[model samples]
Target: MHSRHMSIVIPDTTADAVYAFAADPDNLPQWAAGLASGVRRVGDTLVVDSPMGEVTVRFEPTNRYGILDHDVTLPDGTVVANPLRVLAHPEGAEVIFTVRQRDMTDEQFEADCAAVERDLAALAAAVTV
Candidate 1:
């Protein structure tokens, strides 16, 4: 299993507000650019137009706590678990995403981490804007 974790601090946002936005799979493409270019709902599932191909995404049920876990199913049927969270912080709120190395090389994993950082920054800018 891939083992890496990353987080970002979004100023002037509450955990509840962040969770409300991030927990929704429809908002993913707006923030997680590496995941998909766009997302649309089809009945109970979300279809994403990803660079890898069309993928399916399923998010966990909403809860009071800021747990935004989801699963992404690739065209080849590989399911990747994405564990995300928004937690209350002294300044504002912190969004955390688990970054798994998967089968990528070190350089690839570094690039993936960079992508996650960019995504988180986009999320920060989006919510703040």
Candidate 2:
């Protein structure tokens, strides 16, 4: 169960602001490339059009602690929990995403890491104070 923590600091943005923006499912497609195709709400469920097919995404309830954790249910019924956070930083806000190497090859894990980096970059660009 190896994991890699990747982060990006959003300059001039408060942790609260970043959390508020990123925590919303509506903003996922704008920043999260994996969900770039978009997401739809079907009776309280968030269904994302992913490369792997239609997956369900359930996020943690909104909180002041900056937790943006979510569970992604794949088409095959496998649930993958992704832990993410927006922390207060001197520069502004720092967003961290943990990439777990669950049942993945080294190459797959590396690609996942790179994808997370791009997502964080997109998040940094999308979040504004």
Candidate 3:
């Protein structure tokens, strides 16, 4: 399995604020900045349309933290697992978003990671200030 980790620190945000920002996908464009449009939910999953492509992110949240299982569906009908995590840090927050690229090109994987990193930065911005 292929994996990548990405994280960002929020300067002055509370845990609740950080969690709220990261948990809501609808608030993505407002904060995430990269997503110019569409995001919807099915059960616990969030489907987003990004400049890179369409990716459906699924999550399971407990009392302590949440785990995101993503699936990026290509225009040609290919799909892959996108694993990630959103943890509430004592001082800020940390997110690790990974994509498996068994059949994907190197560029696609890098773009996806970049998208996630941008999203994480925006999330931190929204929560902190």
CA lDDT of 93 in candidate 2? 95
Q: Write the per-residue lDDT of candidate 3 for residues 105-126, one digit (tens) a residue.
A: 7888787677767777776666
Each model's RMSD to truth, in Å? 1.5, 1.3, 3.3
Please count the clashing residue pairs in each candidate, in the order shown: 0, 0, 0
Model 2 bad stretches (over 4 Å): none
Residue-level lDDT of model 1, residues 1-129, one tens digit each, is 566788988888898888888877767777988665668888767888888899988887788888888888999999988898899999899999998988889999899889888999888887888
Q: Taking the tens digit of each residue's C-alpha lDDT, what string does model 2 give over 1-129?
A: 799999999989799999988987889997999877758887666999998999998888888899989999999999999999999999999999999999999999999999999999999988862
Candidate 3 ranges beyond 4 A from true positions: 31-35, 41-48, 52-57, 61-63
TM-score leaderboard ranking = 2, 1, 3
For candidate 3, what is the TM-score? Answer: 0.67
Q: For this target, which candidate reaches the highest TM-score against the unseen true structure? A: 2
Total colliding residue pairs, candidate 1: 0
**TM-score of each candidate structure, all chains considered together:** 0.91, 0.95, 0.67
TM-score of model number 1: 0.91
> What would the C-alpha RMSD of candidate 2 be, to one decimal place?
1.3
Q: Which structure among the candidates has the greatest lDDT?
A: 2
1 or 2: which has the higher lDDT? 2
- Kindly report which residue stretches of model 1 are placed more than 4 angstroms away from their true locations once superposed: none
lDDT of 1: 0.85
